[model samples]
Target: MELDGQRKSDNVEDVRGRSGSGFGQGNFGRRGIRFPSGGGGRGLSLSTIIILALIYFGLRAMGIDVAQLLDDGSSGSSSYQQQSNASGAEQEMKVFVQRVLASTEDVWTDIFEAHGGQYDMPKLSLYSGQYPSACGTASSATGPFYCPGDRKVYLDTAFFTELSRRFKASGDFAQAYVIAHEVGHHVQNLTGVLPKFNQMRQTMTPAQANKMSVRVELQADCFAGIWGRKADDKGLLSAGDLQEALNAAQQIGDDALQKRAQGYVVPESFNHGTSAQRMKWFKRGFDQARMEACDTFSDPV
Candidate 1:
C-alpha cells in the first residue's frame, strides 16, 4: 500500500507499557472475557477471601503483580499521554495503524453521508499485554476486537507478528483488512445490527447463537472488502493487495483455525464461517461496493 502522503488519524490512543485494568488473569475469547469464577454472591465468604489471598501471594512470589490485575485504572499515570521508547519497527507499525484508521474514517464517513446519515467515528485503542475496555479486559490473546459498550476498536499490535508467523498471512493490506474488519463491527453497532444481535443472542441457544454469529462475522468481512474497494479507487492498493486480504480471510476462517488446533472439526461450533464463505462474502463486497450487497443475514449464508 502506498501511504506516503496519506493522513493519519488522531483518534488513536497508545496505551502500550501502561498497567492494564480489570480483574482476574485469563485470556479473552474472540469478543468476550473469560473471567475465573469464585462462586456467585454479592460478597466473598471468609474462606473464599483466604483462598484468593493465598493465590495472589503465590502469583506474587512468581514475580507477577496481582494488584495490577485488579487495577481500576484510577491510580496510574494517564495512559493517554504516556511516553514510550518503541523500536523503529513498532513505531512504523503504529504509523501504519493510524493511516489505516484514517482511511476507514474517511471511507465510512463518505459512505454514511451518501446514505443521508452522518458517520459517528469510533476511536481505536492500541495496547500491549492487556487493557481495560467498557466491554471487558482486552488481552493480546483476544486478538483485535471492537467493543460495542465503548464504541472503540481495541488492538494489540503484536497480533500482526502472529498473523505473519503463525497464520502465514503476511502483507500490509492483510493487516489493514484486520483493522477494517474491526471497524466494520463499529459500523454495525451504529447501524443497530450489532445491538439487535446482542439482544437476540441472550435468548438463543448456543448452537443458534453460533449460527447467527457466523453471519455477523461474515458481514464484517464483507464490510472490510468494501473499504478495500474504496482504497483501491484512491490508488492506495498495490498489485497483490487484494490477494493478501483474500488469503487472510482464508487463513483465519473458523474452520481453518479449528482444524489446525484439533484433528477434527465440529460444524455446530463454527461461529465465523468457513474459508469459502469468508472469501465469497468479501469478494462480493469488493465487486459490488454497496452495503446492500453485503447482507448475509437476509439470505442463506
Candidate 2:
C-alpha cells in the first residue's frame, strides 16, 4: 500500500480526540462501556441490560417463563450518538483513510461510468468512542459500518488495532478492505438491492433471513475484492496486498467470529458467510474484476 503522492479525499470528517456533543466528561470503563449520547436523549444502558439478563435467567431457574428475557433484541437496537475529535497519530491515520477512500472513489467512478451509470461519492465519518449516523448511534465496538439511510460510512479507527492485534489480519490493505466492504453496501443501497433485501426479510423466516444476510455480506466482500483487483491493475497494490484483504475477509467470517466467541458455529445463526464462502466470493470478484461477478444473491451462496 504505497499511498505516497496519492490524492486524499475531501469528504472525510475527522472527529478523533474531541468530546461528544451531548455527552459530558466520562472515562471508558474496563467492561467495554462507553455511552452513546445524541441530542440529549438517554443512552442505551448496558448496565441495566446486564442486570436484567441476570434477573431473567435467575427467574428461568425458578420455573418462571422468561422467553422475552432471553431474546437478543440488542441486534436491532442502536446506541445514542456523541460528538468527537481527532489528533496526532490519529490525524495521520485520518489522512490515510481519506486517501484510501479517494482511491475507491476513483476506482468505482470509472467502473460505473464505463457501465453508463453515475457514481455518487459517499462521505466517511471518523469518530473515536461514538457518533451519530442515519442508521443510529454508532459505537467503536460496532466496528466499521455503512448506514444506508444516510449514505455515509462510520469508522472507528481503533478497529485497525483489532485487525492487527486480535484478528491477525494486519496491514493497510486489510483496513482498506473494511472500508471498501462498507462502500460495497452503499453500492447495494444505490442499486436497490438493500431495500429489496429488507423487504424480503420481512416475509422470510429467521433462518431464511439470516441466509439472505450472508449472501448480502458475501457480496460486499466480493465487491471489496473487485476494488482490490482494480487497485492491483492500476499498480497500487504491493506484494501480499491481495492476501491482506483476503485474510481480512476470512478473519471476519461469521464462522470464525462465532467459534472464537462461543466455541461453536451455528450455520442458521450466521449472518455472514463461512471462511471458505467469504474467501471464495472475494476471489470471484478479484478474478473477474467486475460488479456482475459479485452476484451472490442470484446463485446459491
Return the top candidate by lDDT.
1
* lDDT of each candidate versus the true structure: 0.90, 0.85
Q: Residue by residue across 1-301, what tens digits does model 2's lDDT show?
A: 9888899999898866554555433542233335465445675467667876798789989998766544444433341111122234676898899889999999889998999999999999898888767787888888899998889999999999988999899999989989999999988888889999989999999999999999999999899889888888878889998899889888888899998888999888999899889989988989999888899978777
Can you write out model 1's per-residue Cα lDDT over 147-257, one digit (the tens) per residue? 999899999999999999999999999999999999999999999999999999999999999999999999999999999999999999999999999999999998899
Report the number of clashing residue pairs per model. Answer: 0, 9
Alpha carbon lDDT of residue 3, candidate 2? Answer: 85
* lDDT for position 276 in model 1: 88
- List runs of model 1 lying over 4 Å from the truth: 22-86
Residue 108 error, candidate 2, Å: 0.9
Residue pairs clashing in model 2 are 15-85, 16-85, 16-86, 17-85, 17-86, 18-85, 20-83, 21-83, 37-81
TM-score of 2: 0.77
